[model samples]
Target chain A: MDLDILINSLRNYDGITRKNFIRGATQILDETYNIGGRTALGFGDDASALDIGNDTLLLMAADGMWGRLIEGDPRWAGYCSVLVNVNDIAAMGGVPMGMTNVISVNKEDICNEIMLGIKEGVEKFGIPMVGGHIHPDTPYTALDVSITGIVGKDDVITSCGAKIGDSVIIGMDLDGRQHPKFPLNWDTTSHKTPELVQSQITVMNSIAKKHLLTAGKDISNPGILGTLGMLLEASGVGAIVELEKIPRNKKVSWDEWLKVYPGSGFVLTSKEENVKECIEMLQEVNITSQVAGIITEDKKLNLRHDNQEKVVFDFNHDIIMGIKEERS
Target chain B: MDLDILINSLRNYDGITRKNFIRGATQILDETYNIGGRTALGFGDDASALDIGNDTLLLMAADGMWGRLIEGDPRWAGYCSVLVNVNDIAAMGGVPMGMTNVISVNKEDICNEIMLGIKEGVEKFGIPMVGGHIHPDTPYTALDVSITGIVGKDDVITSCGAKIGDSVIIGMDLDGRQHPKFPLNWDTTSHKTPELVQSQITVMNSIAKKHLLTAGKDISNPGILGTLGMLLEASGVGAIVELEKIPRNKKVSWDEWLKVYPGSGFVLTSKEENVKECIEMLQEVNITSQVAGIITEDKKLNLRHDNQEKVVFDFNHDIIMGIKEERS
Candidate 1:
């Protein structure tokens, strides 16, 4: 329940460890990130923005389900495919337009179950599953989903846009419980009304349109700190955050709370002048948000609470995403 | 090979046979195809088209590599992920803008190699690989890619736009050989200059802008004839194609020739007024196209060559895509 214990647990978690490889992968992809002029924002962001002209930018992102997740429950894997990709676009403050999926399966039943899940997710999110390819005879079953959305060119949020002296805020929808089947996942959207969950995504759009944040990203598998670490690394900045200031369900312990992947949550940094407006917009859609830290020029994430402070991430020494957005 | 042998070989080829499951998926998806009220063309086409306002439309498509393909050469799978999606947009007479991928792998080496291939593809195609998600822990490796393109709404091509009296034209770039690992693949772009390959894709945009084809689709896993069958099903019409009129590499046998998945080939239909312009444009890009036959009201695909005409697909009993656009 203490700070060190929670930090160690999160750092050692497989979900957090798995993201280290992203740094290396981004290194190889570094060369061709901006091959064309259409790329407004490329790697190390929840969604890449494309300059589509006419004051509009296109947001694109893709997500693949873990093979273990598919093996455990193909239907849940299918549903999560939509959920994760949608979240990626939402984090960028874009209006999701449609989705496409590629599914490979050897069994008919598994494919059917995954399709059923996709159907439900599509209905809940109000986004169409447009077009995709299917492999009927793969040795293993896997599902990957990709999404596209649109946003005004001047109003897009990006991880790499975070700046020094900005206030960092953690916003989360805490009105939910951990999924019964997936322990590390905090289930919020499934139990809530579709209208409420969708409005939660739209509220971020309102925030972006109003220029309430300098930078933002969705909280994902690496959980809150891991997600913040990636955003800071992308922006080439660091932060000193108070662990006690972060919003929590209170029922979940500190260790569990820090690592839970909430259905709707975000890590954002903005000028102090805009924090109140940002918090108010998110609150309108059921997100509880608070300023937890201030971004600094030093490339380290320092955590503080109860008159005790510890270094959680030193980006210069330990790479989280390693990708500096301007370079990537 | 004799006509019967060639027909039977094309029917049984894995590239063509695997598509038989598409109808089953469409049936399951049923009405969810048009969720946002702007899907001009859905499931049974090379790519789905969405009306994005301002006399312009967005084209979206996704493709996943076969597991065997991924296992055989992960690099090629990654490269082809871009290749296939790009071709999908080209076939629709749209200008490709960008692509995103979903990659799942347990090993760092596999991920690295795939990213290398993707980098090569981006440089070659002159398009950017914008953003995507990675599942660092998976039981097996898989790569799925999705693409978006732009087209003028009035000039867009659709699989279901073929008229009863339209001319059937099968155009393909014949300047390549079969791949070493994947024998059924016609590897055209690998050996040629990127300028030439990119020009081939751009030529489709020219055709669209000039207002040419009645119906069109990229020739994918289902080869030429099966792809034609899908077009016919979508168009609510049939055609009798002269089997001899289809462009082919004489070095490959008839059986192998009919089933090869070409790098840049398309099955297109046009009214007589547009036939000359269509063939001329296709030839400018090294795609040898000829007027093969005529579309008919009879819902059947017939193949004819040298005093021998045979019915290849009887749509009354068989369904290639099983989707009749609009069901009118």
Candidate 2:
């Protein structure tokens, strides 16, 4: 596919469009986000960090399954609930401790399927799903999972730490196929062994501890380039990507690949000196990693392929989440 | 009301009835509740406890607002989400760190009102709502909030620690009226200063640190007697209480008071020697306190008034949550 077509498709993707809604809700929450002085990093990050003293920080994040996804397949929705929340913690380079979920369902069958899926995901991720509330008689089915993790105060990775001289790394366990029910969901962890699946997360912790990555975020529904845009927006920087260098399975088409929410994918920024080691660590865990782009002082993401270039996101005017980290 | 009548009424209360739905969901989750081994107290508790090392444990809990409450008053629903989750951590005698929420809304007005309510709650509780996900196009509106707190591993309290002969104390801030739309909601914190409302939580932390309580729980949707029944079930014990000794607002009828979800109400168990101090500390925060009962060896909760005693919950036959904490 041509650069212009791929850029336009991703720019108009529903995954990106849906994020605009966050701005309104967050605006109302803006004042109270830092009500307590212990908030180390509040909104605009994969997880909010709270200082608990003793050089330890607690990480918290929540994600809700889309109604469409839940309606299509409750089991996938349940499994994805864990995957998404776990990835949120993993992106922050924290050790995910546990998760709690709130599920609303009217049917027993659907509830059972979802719970089984969650059980599978929990086993695969190696994180306990300890406790949560169940709204048993809601008119619709929905699942929201929240995760908590811990990281050293100094070893934390955040979305707003990217710098102009950094290299943008795109990593994904590309040996997987798309989910049967949800085409956008690239299923990587399900077929893999539990030990291998968990390494995708622990590898990030090792990266964080070594101070390898300047900023990182999981490739979620917003996909690779879109997720990168969010990190850039938070960091007040931009990137110029050689589109062909982005690691992807050859089986998937370009438009679909750009929007696929992989089971294990991450977009990270690291100093040029740290790129080799960071990619090596991720590769050791079976994640295909490569330096696909370079961070730039200009606040726009420029995509290049086949001697052609196109501007996909201009942070100066575009609003992915319309948020900038409130640094504590 | 007669003892038998009240017993029957509470047994059939909707708050308690709704809990039955949790049985099916939890039964499925039981197998994996302690999958990661880090869970110190999994399931069957107000908050799940996970050992995070350094003599500190992490507490996690989630609560979803009832659809009826959301429909009745979105603002109150939003505020209650925070109140409920914070109380979960407080009930565990932990210091609440932060909360995250997932809100699903299709209407802009309802969304704004809910956010406003959440903002008010965040400010009142003095705990931040750091991060969350928003589903803007759901067919139905809902809100789920999850919280994390920290407590010394040795100092943490659990519902399953009630020992025979422990005094059962019912503590509540009776200086409140019923909510206009939700009569069972005893609205206490909204009118109070942030300091006083926060004291309601910090007092629990103090109690935990002092090791004065054997078992404790916040009075939530299941109300006073129903909540106490849960504590008894978890501890593999029972209680005999004098109904009149239960701290209650004189203005509310006995039936309503027994079923009211108090803003700051707790059913606690403490050794006889520590009961006086526990009550005094709770009372210092305007939470009216009294020793209403004694934990018993029998597996049933017996209620007494005017020499007439009747069993309220037969643990052998009744299952409030159908969960037994996997104590690690």
Best by DockQ: 2
- lDDT per residue (tens digit) for residues B1-328 in model 2: 6878888899999899888888788777777777878889887899999998888899999999999999999999999999999999999999999999999999999999999999999989989999999998888999999999999998888999999999999999999989999899999998999999999999999999999999999999999999998888889999999999998889999999999999999999999999999999999999999999999999999999998899999999998886655479
> Across the candidates, what are chain A's individual TM-scores?
0.96, 0.98
After the best TM-score superposition of candidate 1, give how far the Cα of residue A198 lies from its true spot, in angstroms. Answer: 1.1
TM-score, cand. 2: 0.99
Cand 1, B chain, TM: 0.96
Task: Label model 2 with its docking quality class.
Answer: high
- DockQ values for all predictions? 0.77, 0.87
Q: Which ten residues in a row have the lowest lDDT in candidate 2 chain A?
A: A1-10
Error of 2 at B139 (Å): 0.6
Model 2 stretches astray by more than 4 angstroms: none
lDDT of 1 by residue, A198-258 (tens): 9988888888899889999999988999999989999999999998899999998888888
RMSD of each: 1.7, 1.0
